[model samples]
Structures are given as C-alpha cells and as structure tokens.
Target: MTGAVLAERTEMVDGAPSALAALRRGEPVVLTHARERHLVIAAERVTGRTMALLVRYSSGFACVAIEGERLAALDIPLMEADDAGREAFAVSVDAGAGLTTGISALERARTVRALAHPSTTPADLVRPGHVVPVQVRPGGVLERPAPPEAAADLCRLAGLVPAAVFAAIPESVSEPLPTALADLTTVRVEDVVRHRERAEPLVHPAAVAPLATRRGLLTQHTYVDVRGGTEHLAVVAGAVADADAVPVRVHDECLAGDLLGSVRCRCAGDLAAALDAVATAGNGVVVYVRGGAACGGQPTGVAVPADRDRVAAHVLRDLGVRSVVLLTDDHGHAGRLSAFGMPVVACAPLTPAGQCDLRAGAVE
Candidate 1:
C-alpha cells in the first residue's frame, strides 16, 4: 500500500507538543501529506532498538534530522552505539540559504540512500542550517522516494520547527509500531536545538595493560576526555627510536574493517601497516583514535580529520619525544603537524599483505 492510503485519516493527527514529547521518549511518529508519509524521529533519541523498529516498520532504514546549532551538542555516545547511527550523525550542513530544499525526484531518492550508507559523509543534498542524515541501506536507491514535503508538513502540522529530514520507507501497509516506539513522534527541532547540551571534556590518559601482538610487546594507554566524556587509545610498539622525529600515526577507528575484517575500506590494512612500520623501526607510536564515539560519531576519513594531533603530540611529549615524523594518508593531519614544526610523511598505500609499499626504510 502507498503512504497515501495509510495516512488518509488526517483527523487522527496529534498536537505538535505531544508528538515532540513522544519523540523524546523514543517513539516513531507517522506524519502524512496528500500522498506522502514520513516516520519522523529526533536524532538525539535514536537508539539501536529504535533504529531496528524504524527500519522494520518502514520496511527500510530511517533518516535523521538535526538543527544547525545543535550539531556540536550531539550525543556522541548515542551516535557511536550503532553503525547506522554513526552514518546518520556524520551528515553536515551550514544553515539557512545553505539548507537543501529543491531536488529532482531521482536525486532525492539517491540522497536519502546515500545518507544511510556513506563512506565519508555525502554532500550533495545541502540543507542549509541543519544536518539531516537518513538511515537507508544502499542499492535500493529508487525503492523509496524522499519525503521532503511530508517532513515539512509533519513538522508544521505538529507545530514543530524543522531541522533536517530523514526519508524512510512509507508505512502505508505497516501495522502500528509496538509499544516501545508506538509514539515515535517529534517536537520542534528548534526546541531540541535550543536546549542541546555541550560536549563533555576530555581530562587525562590512564595506562591500561601490556598487550602482545604478533609484531611485538606493546603497552596500551587509554585517555578519557572527561569533559567530552569519551575515551581514546594509544598503542606503543616499543622504546622511542628518536625524540626529534618519532614515527607516529593518528589512525581513526573503523568498526567494519578494523575489527570485522571487512574490505570495504583499507582502515584495517592501514592500521596494521602503521603498527608494523612502527614495529619494524623498533620504536614509534600509533594513536588509534576512537574518533566516532569520542567526537559524537561523525564520519571518519575527511568528515573527521582525526583532530587527534594534540593528543598524539601529547603522547610523544610524555614519552620524552620533542618532535614527530607524522605518518598518515590525510593531508589535513600532515598540514596540522607541519605547522606545529613536526616533520610530516604522507603514508604510501599498503600492500595486500598489510605491509607498507615502500622502498627499504622510506616513509617520505
């Protein structure tokens, strides 16, 4: 059935305030227009369970909306808890004129799916002042149409302000959601944006334990950003090779490749190469950044430039190293460390064996 049939009963719609409260309490709300239906929910309220329900109810993944100003106030812990949540959290926007409004039907459909499965954050659908990322699975681009109008209508009918819209499968044929998310509803994206909280601080690092990998014995160090209330890790291969030019890599965390051995990205290989390079050199530091959870689950790669420079530098300094020979693929890090007077080396790609494809003793 199409959303038109499901949303035909316009009289049953609830007030905006109650709908907004339902969203805060983790409910899925169905909003309809002439022929469109939207399953709207707040980004802050998204959980793995709710995500499952949203996807199941809509017969596809859910989309997310966030106000511009509340971007920084996003719940990092919540974003990192689920893979799709991370993808949704990564979409960015400026505000106002920059907001995305107009789009071809095909383009909107593709954008919604892209937002769900991003390598980095997708940038095509620019919605000024708000960041809306949808939880769509890839490869069914045309399966669901974008609900731009329905999102706006729902927000307007519910008396809620708009931020970004996450397009989901129409619930025309779906049954009422279970009790957990029966009230999946929303409030003014504006109110949530206005009442958003600041990120917690990252205080200091604490030593974990010595972990022995195939390469060698390594000491693990964990630092909690108490203010940000997140944790970061540093894997030390061996004694410092040189204080002036210590080999170091600021690696971003990847759930798929690093842990699950997925080949979608080279993160796993990159990480192994970094560790091996450091091990071969018999010294150096590999700072594995929990960039996602630590910084509110933004997209890895370009979206988050691994702003762990200060943390990496701190680790080196604490190890009695004054400077570093930075190892990385991202030019952003290369530039940041170079400005700080550290020698930088843009990392070469790794061979299939997870070894650096470089001439003997070359990182430049």
Candidate 2:
C-alpha cells in the first residue's frame, strides 16, 4: 500500500518505497489511516482497457468516492509545496483516510457560534426599490418595484439595517434615491410608502387549462374564486371506457422518477404502459386521479393508501364503465376496490414490461 497522511496543517508524504514505486508504475494503491483503509483500484483490474482510476472510499467516508475515467486524466503531482497544492493533498488524504466528517460540519459549527454571539441582526441579501418578481396564482412571473415599505419589511424580516436594505435594492430604484437615503439608518418613512404604492399594481392572477382532449388526460384550475389567482391542475385519466371492457390504470405523481424517467422508481414505466393500453383501445378514459386524497383534515398532498382506487371506482361506475380493468403498483389500491360491485384487475410489481403485456392481454 502507498499513501500520504494529512491532518490539520502538517502532512506526511513518505510511504513504502516499493509500494510508492509500484504506484508510479501505474499499479493500484491502498490508503490507510485511523484504522480505516480505501482502495484506489486501477480500471484495468475490472476492464481489460486502461481507462479510469476507481477510488472506493471506506464506508465511513463513502460520500467522497470518485469513479470513472476522469481521475486518470489528472496530472498526479509528485509533491505539494504551495497552499493550494497542500489543500488538494489534504483533501485526497482525508478522503482516502476515511475521515467520515466533512469540512462543511466544521464551518456550520463556526457559523452557529458566531450567530450565538451576534450583536446585530443578519444582513439582508435583497434590498428595497429593487424590482423582484412575484409568482402570481395563474402562470407568469410579475416583476414589481420593491418600494421602500416592502424593502423595510424585508429588512426587518432579514434582521438587516434599513439602509443596508436600501443599498441592496435593485440598481434602478437605488440610483434614483438621494445619497443620504442610501445610508442604512437614513431611510425615510415616506420613501418606503411611495415604493409600496408603486409596487402594488404589479401582481397578476393566472390559471391552467388542458391543451386539448386526448387519451388519459384532463385539465382544470385549482382555485377559481380568488382574484389574480392562477393555479392549474392537470388531470390524467386512469382508465377509459370501452364497449367490451374498461381499461384503467391508477398512477401516482412521481416528479423525479416519472417525469424525468429516473430509474430509482417504477412510476414512469407504469404510467407509460397504462397510457399505451388505454390509447390502443381508442375509447377508454384514463381518470387521472390526483396522487393525494381529497379528504379533509389529512396533510396536504399525502396519498391515502387506497384513495385513488376508490375514486377510480366511483368515476368508472358513474360513467357506466363496466368490465373495468384496474391497474396499479399499490396492493392497497386493489383492497380498496374489492368491495365494489365491478370487476377490477390489478398489476402488482408493475414493471413496464409486465404492464405492457398485461394491458395487451398477453398475460392474465
């Protein structure tokens, strides 16, 4: 094994001469410290080609492991002399030595200590007279003036001096103000009031509607009564009605895995199979139930175990969707609809391949 040890300011660069020479010869290196060790495995060990350097940090310091061919391209310096080089060496040593703690933890501790002894409120990152955009209910971003009043309010919220607040304001508003007013303590009540007045008219409302009727989708606004409010709900149908049989799929909204096709979850595959099944029939409706339940008193956006399944049954029954096929990865969904009078089919362990075949009647 060949490695360097680093802690605090001092670092040791020496190692076994044979091992060090082996490393220079492009052989693998094993780093050890504090009873922990890590292997810098050569890519040739895994694959026939000499491509990458794979550093497998110990489990305690697993967070810092870097893989792939990028590491092999770096120029490995024989020694460290300057502060930057020393710091780089320290990082590698600490990472290889399995130092479980991160430098961020020390910085956070220092910040906490400083905040504990604070004599003044924190500085505001944003200032008044700046035109910050507000996202109104429906759709677009509304850029409005950060009047003195709003600035003062923001400063107060951020625990910053009002003058500091003014200075931080967008250049357009701050440039027009007198130099004296730019001082953190010199902001006037009238200035804030005037700024607020100029800002009041910029807020707007918006909503979202479906682009058009199509397979497995519907759309509507969430809140209709509030003025200047804009929030739209995109409803996807779970199952569509058919003359011979109704095909349905219960889908949960997975922002990352479904929309992004992240392999971490099966949401995207299941949704695609369901949509494909309904679309092929050319008559079924996919009643896209919102992931969470509509029940009052429940935490917002929490999907109750069987809420969507029940909703699906209700919608299907109302629409005269007989011979319905229920699709879902959640076993709880099947339990919820079991008591209903209609026949329902569930696709558990709902893999995309499995769902595709099931929906196509290739599997029972």
Candidate 3:
C-alpha cells in the first residue's frame, strides 16, 4: 500500500480502547486485518442473538480463539499432534452438560462460555463437539496481528479471558472498514498500532543498577511515570537491543501472590518462571508494573492495564530490543507491544508447571 493509502486507512481506525469498551459492555466488534474483516465477540458474551448474526454474515464456522496452554489444561490437544500447522486449530469441543445437542446457536454459545470460564476443566467439555477452539498464536496480535489474534487481544484488553468468538465476514478486503455493523464498533489492527504509535509511552527513566542475583548478573531499570506515578522495573539479562525475537515478560505487580507466595494464584510461580527464562536466555527482559488491576476483580495477574502494557513496550524499544518472542507466565497476554512497533514474534511458556492450569487465580 502507498503511504497516502496507509495514512487514510490509519485515520479510519479508533483502536483498542473503543473496541475494549464495547466488548466490556457485551457488544460485538468488527476487527480488520490487511483488507479482510471479521465480526468478533467476546466468548463470555456470545449469545443466541449474536450467534445468529455471525452465522448469517460471517463464515459459518465460528471459532473461539484461546491460549494454547489453556487447551492443555482442559485436556484438549491440537488437531495436529506436531502443531506444525499455521491455522492453529485445536480439538473441537462442546459443553458437557445442560444441552441436548451442540449444533443449536444457543448450545454453541454455551460451549464458548465453557471454554472461557476459568473454572472449566476437561470434564466440563466434550471433545469433537460443535464449538471449535482456536489457540491464539502467542505474542498474540503482536505475533501475527491478524483477525484471529486481534480478536483475542481485544478481549484481553477488556479484562476478559483471552478467548474470543470470531468469524470472517463475507466482505472483501478492498472495502472500507464499516462504521456500523448493527452498531458494533469497528477496529482495524494497523490502526491500533498507529493509535499506540501516535505518542511515546509516558515514562521517564529514573535509575539503573547492575544487580547480582542467583540467575546471573542482570541489569535493572527503574522508571517513574508522571501519568501513574508508579515505579516500574525492567530487569535485563545481557544485551537485548541488538537481538531478534528476544524473550520479554511484562509482569504486573501482585503483592499478595508474588510476595506472599499465596497459593490462591500462580502469580509467584509465573514470576519465578519468567526470571528463570530471562536468566537462561542470556538476552531478555522482565518488565514489572506496580499495582496491577486484576481482570473483573479476579485475583489473576494476567490482565495488565493497556497503558501499563504500553509502558513496557516503550521500555523494550528504548532498550534497543527489536522484535520479540514473549516469555509469558500465565494466560495469553501480549499487551499493546505490537502497537508501538515492538513486534512480539512468539510466546513461549517457560516451563510445564506454569502451563498446568492457565487460570491460577480463577474462582468458581
């Protein structure tokens, strides 16, 4: 695309916040990638009414996008054993109870909810069922930044489970992003990147120290942000700016879990795992934000506020890190890193223990 065309397209998108607001309010949104568009709905919010809309206008096979680790937690495996396929399709499933058949719109909606629920387990789902769950390819939108990844990213931004129900619209890529699809908000992937890139993250470097720890000699960065007025830390292991697909972990503060070693959440374990990965990687970073807001008041540290995520992104950029492969502790969090031009090439689970139950802080 020409520069003028790119600029015009950028103007058409309002980006994450707008889409996030609508999703939080239980509304669907149009997510665009390249020229193709898809109708996306939060998995938890999918209803009979919305299912009908997707079925009529979208690709008939509506799929729910989720983190691959969550799939393992529920005893679901990728459709392909080797997981070499690009589609990222996993074993299909349906709600295990309260439904006679899985083909109905309402039934499929229930299946989606089961997938998104934190308390849901393998027994709560039946394999080879009506609803298909597609794993979000790590680094989330930062990795691919396509419709599927964007759907999951938007859901996460709304402080919901990263699972999303999305289906391709019949619309052609040459068409303009719709301002109204039954009044659903529209967000273009590139537009979100531009929106984030419009300004630098609001943070000022305060201090740096060479910290000697068990992992090795790691550098620590402290930043004071005027907006949040919080002291955020970025611990570095060796040189990263010159690397590609460098490992990065954006850890939001969770005192109760990280400090107290509370079994109530996996915050502590995830943090330790991240530290281990960075130390071993020899070229990585762990960005820590203070006072993280849990998703829906849940104790999980998975959801980092969009602004804080942006701060982490800028910190990485300042460190000279180019593209990255996210070293995620739990859930599917890529944040708005890709938005600021710091691409997340992939997401790797540091250890199998961290991969066990994706929702460590979830309650029934």
Candidate 4:
C-alpha cells in the first residue's frame, strides 16, 4: 500500500484515539459519512475559533448534538418532523434570558455550552430560538448512522459528556478537507462505528442452537443488538475451546457470491473452503459477521471493516476459545484483534484444501 492508502486506513480503523486526543486538546475534527461531511467538536470544546469555523463553513444553521434525555431535561420535544430527513432535531433554542441573539457564533457557542452542562434545565433555555438542538440516539451511531449520533459518540468516547457541536461542511466528497483550521482532526462515521466496536462490549449473546449445514452439525450462537441485527451470528464447527489454538475464520456475508455463486467475488468459495477446513480439523471456528464487509478472496483483514473481527473476538471470548490461528491472508489483523482481547493471530495459514488461501499463524 502507498503512504496515502495507509494513512487513510489508519484514519478509518484507529482514528478514534486521535480524534479523542484532539477533543481533549479542545480541537475540532472533520466528520465524513456517505456523501456528506461535517465539522465537529465536543460541545465543551466550543471555543471562539471553533465557533467561527462552524459559522463560516456550515451549509445550514449549526446544531448541538445531545442525548434524548438531555433534550427532555430542557423540556424540549421533537420538531414534529424533519423535512430534510435529518432525524432527531429538537426545536431550536436560545440560552434563555441574558443570552445574546443566538445567531452570532459567540451566542450559539454559549447555548451549546448550556446544552452540554449537567445543571442546565428547562428554565435555562427558550424554545423556537436560534440554536438547533439535536437528540442523538441513546446507542449513538450504532443505532443510527447519522452525523449527530456520530458527533455525540466522539464526546462519549473521549470521556466527556455525550454532547457535540456539528455543522455541515459544504465540501464535496472528492475534495480534500480544507486545512484552514489548526488542530483539525478528521474521521468517518464508519470510524465511529469501528471505534465503538473496539472500545465497547458491542455484541451481546442471546442464544445458541445446533445448525445443520452441508459440512456437518455446527453449533450456532445468536446475538441481540441495538441495530436489531440478525446478521451477526457465529457457527462453531467443532470443540474449539478444547484446543490450545483453534483454526478460525471470521467471515463476512457477501450474499451475491455466498448464495448465488456470483463470480464477482470469491466469497462463496472462501466461506465453503473455511467451513471445510474447520470441519476437517474437528476443532475450529467460522464466525459469520458483517452484512457485506469488503475483504479479498474473502475480504477478511485489517484494511476491511474488522467489525467482523471485533465481533468475532468477543464471540470467541464468549465461546471460551482462549487462543486462535486466524484463517486469513491479511497479516495486519493480528495486531488489531489483539486489542479486542484475543491473542494475536498465529503466523501460519491452515490450508487444508479447496484453494481457499487461508493464512496460518501460531497463537501464543
């Protein structure tokens, strides 16, 4: 990979720490989603410079992101409906009496401070005023992949109160984030998602049962999630816990290839081959995760959304699999997965058969 590609990947997977560091230092970060990007900073970090940045760059009126409970604490209700489809925006507000005409950057900054403060109550603000208040979902971006939730999530991750100030950046997707501001951090919604998975107990166990597959009778474990996700499940091919280091494949779903055998990708072949490898070992794991995580041969690596691996790491710990020989070619995963509590993937590829080029590594 080139230097730029490496830097971009770092921003995607491990950028949260840097973003949090920026927040701690009272700096701003650029936030990106699908086709949109925003300038975000912890509400507590709303300095004069930050406010100027928001005021100058925002395509619309800047908003403060807070939890639903915070919105209610201020006696604020939903804005009936969002015409723009930007959900969770409560009514606009000013910082009550003695507050400036809320439109000014300074005034909006004060209102944001009040919104983020713990002692601020309903009497502290007036409704239908200048500053827009957005109620982020309780589960942050994992529940709703919106800029408000993502902005708020950064605050939570940084150990501050879960409140943030964000405004749309009028830049296009192809444009580089304008470097006009100092201490400007940059991150993605996917970064927030990946950050949460890495830092929180993102997946929860609900049930397990025997699943009859073409390979054999695999034990399937299901999970409950805030996303109402059914796609995150695990299939244990054999008694992996009994082994010192079991062969494991953290597979992401690619329906086009896995089901219809679409030659667009080798997902079907790799999954089948992984299952076969585990079955043959009679002591391995094949974790099914990610709706369409992009990997190669099967896109299961650090460059991909290792949300699947993070999910798998938790599942493996839950399943009592102490160590693992990760079945993947992407050697980069070992370091990342280790942080999620699994030992680093061993350095060997378990190539039992079927051209599934799975790497084998020693787990120690």
Give all TM-scores, in the order shown: 0.37, 0.29, 0.54, 0.62
* Model 1 per-residue lDDT tens digits across residues 275-318: 88888887778877665421112223343342455445444545
Compared with the true structure, all predictions reach lDDT values of 0.47, 0.32, 0.74, 0.72
lDDT of 3 by residue, 82-167 (tens): 34236688888999898887988888988998898989989988878988888877766555656777788778778898889988
Identify the superior model by lDDT, candidate 2 or candidate 4: 4
* Model 4 lDDT per residue over 1-364, tens place: 2323333343335567788988877787888887787888799778767788777866757888898887877898888764334677788988886776677778788888888888888988888887788887777876676888889998988999899988887764245545564447778787787667556665688888998887778888886544556557777877777464678887766665677755655567778788888887777888887653543334343334455566777778778787677776556665455545566436345453323322222111
The reply for model 3, stretches above 4 Å from the true place, is: 1-12, 81-85, 172-182, 192-364
Give residue 164's error in model 3 in angstroms. Answer: 0.4
Clash count, predicted structure 1: 30
Off by more than 4 A, model 4: 1-13, 81-86, 172-177, 202-275, 281-284, 288-313, 316-364
Please state every model's RMSD to the true fold in angstroms: 21.0, 26.9, 15.8, 9.7
Ranking by TM-score: 4, 3, 1, 2
lDDT (C-alpha) at residue 139 in model 4? 71
* Top candidate, metric lDDT: 3
Q: How many residue pairs clash (N, CA or C atoms closer than 3 angstroms) in each of the candidate models, in the order given?
A: 30, 25, 2, 12
Residue 16 CA displacement from its true place in model 2, Å: 86
Cα error of candidate 2 at position 92, Å? 75
